[model samples]
Target: MSGPPAAPVSGLRALPAPDDGWKMLLRKEVLRFWRVAFQTIAAPVLTAVLYLLIFGHVLEGRVQVYPGVGYVAFLVPGLVMMSVLQNAFANSASSLVQSKIMGNLVFQLLTPLSSWNWFVAYVGAAVARGLLVGLGVYLVTLLYAPPRAAAPLWVLAFALLGAGMMAVLGLLAGLWADKFDQMAMFQNFIVMPMTFLAGVFYSIHTLPGIWQALSHLNPFFYMIDGFRHGFFGASDVSPWLSLAVAGGSFALLSALALHLLKTGYKLRN
Candidate 1:
């Protein structure tokens, strides 16, 4: 009472409370993968390199998909996109499903974190991982077959959009899956098939007319095709169409993921 309560004496000045919940979640997701760099980062890079070696040697001079481009050169962009897509999908899907199974997801809900924050955090982390893996594959592949870019901007755009699209799809897969088995089923049955069929190893133009049309129906094809165009300046479909498909797919999946989060589809109750 002597001096107006002496300004609330304390041992140390109180630190400002953290307000950016999304940033914390994003950081956590990033660190989660970074902590296991050997598994999450190095393993994929190694797998990609192996693909390059095995496929490059086998198809180097045999397959001439792009006009003047060697098969190995054509393969590099596809490998890069494949790594980006798979890793991006895996990052968000595994994180969410694992959190749900381990019963720690409820803790996140209890925080002031909003659904939008959740979306940003999960998708952003997935994109980061996907891009890193893609970059690793690209850099490593250059050693064996150095492919020059015709349109680097298109390469970057398709890479980002493709990764983002897969990330959003992963969010949906995570919410719908209750167990690890279901997640595995989703990956093996849906993701793996689509990716492999998306023309990672060959071009759609080499297929029959019916097959070529069907291949165009697969959104992953556009991503890979568009990405290849960036390198060779040619593709099965127009670059603009590829951009539209990839961009549109991302928007649609993002909306669905957001809806799931807002309604607490699987996370709550």
Candidate 2:
């Protein structure tokens, strides 16, 4: 006998139409934060503004960085980078953990989304959130002083690479963590410390020799330093070197993220 009646067609496609699934997932991830703009977007912008005002007011001439550049000018890139880094991590990590806790992760795992598709979707979404916040931070900071673009391409490069690296790392963290508290501990203890230490407020040159050397080891340093270079055309190190470090980290994190998703590590269990 013939099947009862043809079911209504739905937007979701099967494996053969992988693009549809990938796009849908990406859109879903974007809308997730867009829906909470006040919390996700507006709050970060406000925080960056406050930081620029407070720091710029207190340390205008007290802190001399890059010789001629004002302290306010130096602080903008760092705040933008900080916003990008934090939000990028938050987007993917929160999405995955929430899905897991709510028992909807199985639905995603059962989909036809390939590992690469998952990577692109989650990371793409995270990167979008990051760039959005970074741009917002930059614009907000500009109200205090002009945003001179010394090397626009380099600025774009760092923003994209830095955001992508964190996005992949977030995916990896999401794969490893079983609960929200565990992710919070990771963010608070590890991510926050690393970002803050990445030269958000002052030049690494101001630090003691040993601390300066230690800063060199932080990938976040490369991100902020390189981005600042895009603004002032100077940084603690060569922009090319920063590009290499950030680019390498992005590739490595992408590999790790894809591997976890492919193997269903901690996710399937």
**Best-matching candidate per TM-score:** 2
Let me know the TM-score candidate 1 reaches against the reference structure: 0.92
What digit string (tens of lDDT, one per residue) describes model 2 on residues 17-105?
Answer: 34478899999999999999999999999998999999999999888788789899889999999999999999999999889899998
Every model: Cα RMSD to truth: 7.6, 5.3
Mark the 10 consecutive residues where model 1 has the least summed lDDT.
8-17
lDDT by candidate, in order shown: 0.89, 0.89
Task: Record all residue pairs in model 2 with backbone atoms less than 3 Å apart, i.e. clashing.
Answer: none
Give candidate 1's root-mean-square deviation (CA, Å): 7.6
Q: Give me the displacement of residue 229 in model 1, in angstroms.
A: 0.8
Clashing residue pairs in all predictions, respectively, total: 0, 0
What stretches of model 1 exceed 4 Å from their correct place?
1-18
| Candidate 2 whole-model C-alpha lDDT, 0 to 1 | 0.89
Worst 10 residues of 2 by lDDT: 9-18
